[model samples]
Target: MSGLAKRLAGQTAIYGVSSIVGRVLNFLLTPLYTGRFAPAAFGIITGLFAYMSFLNVVFTYGMETTYLRFANRPGTNRRDLYNRVLTLLLLSSFGLTALLIALAPTLMRLLGIPPGSERYAVWLTLILGLDAVAAIPFARLRLENKAVKFASIRMANIVLNVGLNLFFLVLCPDVLAGKYLSGLAPLLRPLYNPSIGVGYVFLSNLAASAFTLLLLGRELLDFRPRLQVTYLGPLWRYAYPIMLMGLAGMVNETLDRVLLARWLPEGFYPGRSSLAAVGIYGACYKLAILMSLVIQAFKYAAEPFFFAQSEDKNSPRTFALVLKWFTISCTILFVAVSVNIDLIAPRFLTSPEYLEGLPVVPVLLLANLFLGVYYNLSVWFKLTDKTYFGTYISFGGAALTIALNFALIPVLGYMGSAIATLVCYVTMAVVCWLLGERHFPVPYPMSRLLLWLLAAVAVVAGSWALPPLGSWIAHMVHLLITLAFVAAVWLVERPERAFRRTQAKAA
Candidate 1:
């Protein structure tokens, strides 16, 4: 690989290592939650998180990307820019927090939560506020290539969150059961309220977010504080579209859950409630967590990695190669998740009730793959300063997603939501690419990427044709299929040719 590609890969791997470990550790909680909470109760957790996704975008207001975009430009005051961003985000975050906290009671009611559940809203506001402030520092670390420190803080947060979850969800519950820790049952009973069932999870997250802020306090305080109202105009001009695009993207990603619940006809299920349907779909969504994890880690590295190299003469080639490799990686993940989901869903992800929604797993996985591609394609808008294009695309996708869910949820339920998700992503990716071709073409090798996607789908589907061999044999078949994909990428993409071609042109 070329030096830039290798460096990008190295950073992505470093970031990915932490993400992989943290997500795996946290991923264990899927079974813990599914095993513990009833379907409707679990549905409440899903819906809250879905809303959190949107609220987080609103809270940050795309300041993280704004900071990165400005910091790398020529003749800019890096420290001054940092200070302005830090001040704006701090004020906005806390101000937003106050508003949400004051409205917590009303918001809880609107969300269908009981009166006592206002603590959930309060905790969520605090988490988002702190997280928004911390995001700039985290983005700084990415810009400065401080991946090791970044990974450490992320992993530590994960450890604390997961450890606390074990205490609240597993150990405390068991101790209260009088089944294992009968001797300490009296001591722990008051501390572990059975009534706070879902509340415990929220409380644990609150503690973790507070701890992360403590860990990042130095970075937060290090910046020299400043505010220039004049500078605010350009920053907001650049950031507003991004912020809206982010909100709309969240709508595409998360509104499905909200719509799936709200749009369901009153008598859709004779015995099952709409919330119960959400619980099933949400758990099945976890089966695709690996795809989300990979995409997230790539984004953390890709934004800085691409921007830092934007002025390079060969950056287009680099971008093309990155797209190919990332597409290959996503294709592999799709096969792994879709093929093993049978064994995966039953044993660890969730209980039998959730298994009813397993059909949506493959659909969501493929959706995330396209979602990742759209993220890569998004660099065009960011680089060209045509971020409004992103707003348009995301709003377009969100409209389609919302419309599809409303139309189809009563007919097909969660499957309808899943279909909507895939359609939206595909639409966004195609539209973005066509616009990029006209405005900021990047030579994305669309034909090869399509082949890789089709190959992945074909391979995953063909695996089911394998006989009911023993579990070990079936695993071996999957293994061989995965390796075959590796070989195909090597032959078709020809890694060495790109290096040689770039070298020949340079020399």
Candidate 2:
């Protein structure tokens, strides 16, 4: 194999394993959380995280991508570049953390969350800040090909977060209130607040972020930072469009939660059902995020690799091939989830009310499939430094997302948000493709891509047409059928046959 291809495969495995394992492990928490916490409580969790997503982009100042671009530039002083970036990140993170803490109460009130809940906001602030500082170092790990360590740190954080959650939610509250504490001090028993559910979730995240900081201590201390204006000038220019894209991208992905809370009038659902419905939507969305998981893992390597190896003749062809395989994998996942959601949703969430959001899962899943394709298509602008064009597309998507959610939420509630998301992602993907071809055309296999998509939609229709054999048994049969359909596509696509022929010729 070629060196680039080999590196891509190895790094992809490391990052993919970390993502898949982390997501699967974290997926276990969905059942526990949805079972225990009220919908409003989950909404609180959802809203806070959505808020953090935007803040993270702000806190990092797009330095991660900036680091990748500058660090790979010819004749660049790698050590100086790394140091300056880290130094700037440290200063910026501290400022952002403090700023958030100071503004926490007002911000909470503005978001329609209660005021005394400043503590949750504070936890989120610290976590985001810590994450921002760790961003480039993490990217550095990817750039330096330290995938093992990269994956290791990510797994460790997930483990710590999950452990802390189980302790606070399951073990601590009961143990502290039980015979042991009761015997020691009856008054102390009253102090145990089992009602402190979502707050504890934030606390767990904070503890995990702190632990991650300590674990990355070696990487943190080793890089000695110094700013150079000449390097940063062009670096900032490259990153500005990325920052806009990141900000707009976050808005498209996340602004719905914020808008839903603000736009939807009270009494949308029965007895705070709006919040609960949002939580349900959030959980179901995770099921669809399988596409996102793969895209994320590929992106970590693909972005830097694309930029660094820009001039190579094989780069565009390789991207085209990756895009095709990405669609195929996502198409398989789409069919599996659309067909077997009845089987999976029960394991992932507890309440029957939560299951109402199941229909949204397939819609959101297909949209994300297109979103991943758009990400692959997005390399054109980045490689050519025409990132502003990408930013414009994301902005258009974000505006559509917000406007649709606003107009429809009062009428449709949580489902409106899902529809808006689906529309926005599809729009972004289509627009990116049209504009991208004009700038830097890659040979995407349109016929194969459409075939996979059409086959997935057909499987969805087939699964739906089959009689409901009582939910459980019906779902099982549908899952098997879905797998059969995917296998059929794999046979027709003939990927393995093509691979063997290429190898034989090379030999």
Candidate 3:
């Protein structure tokens, strides 16, 4: 392997370990959340996070990408650039957080949230602001190629968040019920509701965000404030378009739940059908997104690596090879998830009401697969320094997403949202690949890649033809299906034989 390919592989492993483990830990929380919170509560959780995701992109305003770009520039005083960017982000994010908190009630009402529902808006505002400040250190870690520290911090945050959640949602509730209820009833009586489900989860998140911020203090203190107004013009020129692109991307990804909150039909529940659907969709979406998170962790490390490698002669071939392998692995993941969703779906939300989302799971997984491929391929524009391509492609995807949601939400509701998401990702991936070739071409192995994907999809489709069995039996069948797909890939790739030969020679 070339140096870049080798680096990509190593960072991918580190990223994989952290991402897979963190997601698994977060995955465990889904059951607790679904069991404890009402669907409506989950709706609030979903909506608040959706709002946070949008603001987060805006808060950073494309500085993460800018940092990576400038850090690689010649004689650039990378640390000074880091400090300047970090200071700008910290000041802006805190200012934005304070502003949002003050305007929370008005924003809440404007978004159709109840007047006093500003509680969630407040929590999300602070958390996302802290997250924005934290992004600089995280991006700096990536720039310095500190994948281990990056993964470690991520895992630590997940561990803290998950532990706190278990404490609040499980241990505290039990303690109050068993030992303290009689004594505390006068002052803490409202804490014992078996049903105030989603609020506890959000509270746990707030606590975790505070904890993560504290842990980041050393890195925070290391940076000196240096606002280079001279850098702002070029930075904004580059980052502003990327910010718009990020907004469009987030809308394509998350606008579904927000729109569904309004588009879901009446008679669905007493007063909280939207929340219930949000909980269901959100939980199952987590399952589909596990693969996406893995991709994200890799992209976190991969983007900087790609840009640095662009100056090398062998970069085109190396990038093409990585793209091939990424697609192959991701396609396999999509198959595994689709075939075994019957088993995996229950672990997240076992309720029958939420199981209706099972069918949507496969659609969502494929959409995420497309999304991962798009991100991997997107290095073309970033390398060429023509990031305006990002704005155009993402805007196109967002347009498609909006039009589809508006047209289909009233007709098919949540399912419409799912279909729309899949359509948007597929469209973006295709457009990106087509446009990328014009400026920065790589020899992506389309034929073998399609064969591998077709094999996985065929196995899943064939499995559906069989009669329904018990859950365990169905899981076993799906596992077999996935294993068969993997075996076929190994046979075709012949990686084991080549590895053994290399080992023999080294010995």
Maximum-lDDT candidate: 1
- Candidate 2 error regions (>4 Å): 1-7, 177-195, 500-507
Model 3 worst lDDT run, 10 consecutive residues: 185-194
Clashes of 1: 0
Clashing pairs in model 1, backbone N/Cα/C closer than 3 A? none
Q: Candidate 3 regions off by >4 Å? A: 1-3, 179-197, 268-272, 496-507
Clashes of 2: 1
Location of the lowest summed lDDT over 10 successive residues in candidate 2: 179-188
- Candidate 1 residue lDDT tens string, 1-507: 678888988899899877988998888899999999988898989999999999999999989999999999999888888889999998999899999999999998988865688888888888998888889889888988999989998888888989999998988888887769789887887788877889877888888888888888778878877888899999999999999999999999999998888888876766789888888888888888899999988998999998998899888878887887888888888987788776677876557878888889889999999999999998888988889999999999999998999888989989999999999999999999999898887867799689889988888778867778788787777778877877887776686876786578669
lDDT of 3 at 450: 70
- Candidate 2's residue-wise lDDT over 198-255, tens digit each? 7888888899988998889988998886766776688788787888889999988888
Tens digits of lDDT, candidate 3, 1-507? 445677788898897667888878988888887777767777777888888789989899999998888788779998788898898898899899999999999998888764557787887887888788888888888887888888887888888889878866876676677665456544545544545455566666777777777777777888888997897887788788889999999999898988888777775544447767777788778888777876887788788888788798878777877877788778878888888877777777856667777777877888888888889889898888889999999999999998998888777767788999999998898899888889988877677777776776678778767798987787888898889888887787775664464357548
- Candidate scoring better on lDDT of 1 and 2: 1
Residue pairs clashing, model 2: 83-225
TM-scores, each model vs. reference: 0.95, 0.93, 0.92
RMSD of 1: 1.9
User: Total clashing residue pairs per candidate?
Assistant: 0, 1, 2
For TM-score, candidate 1 versus 3, the one ahead is: 1
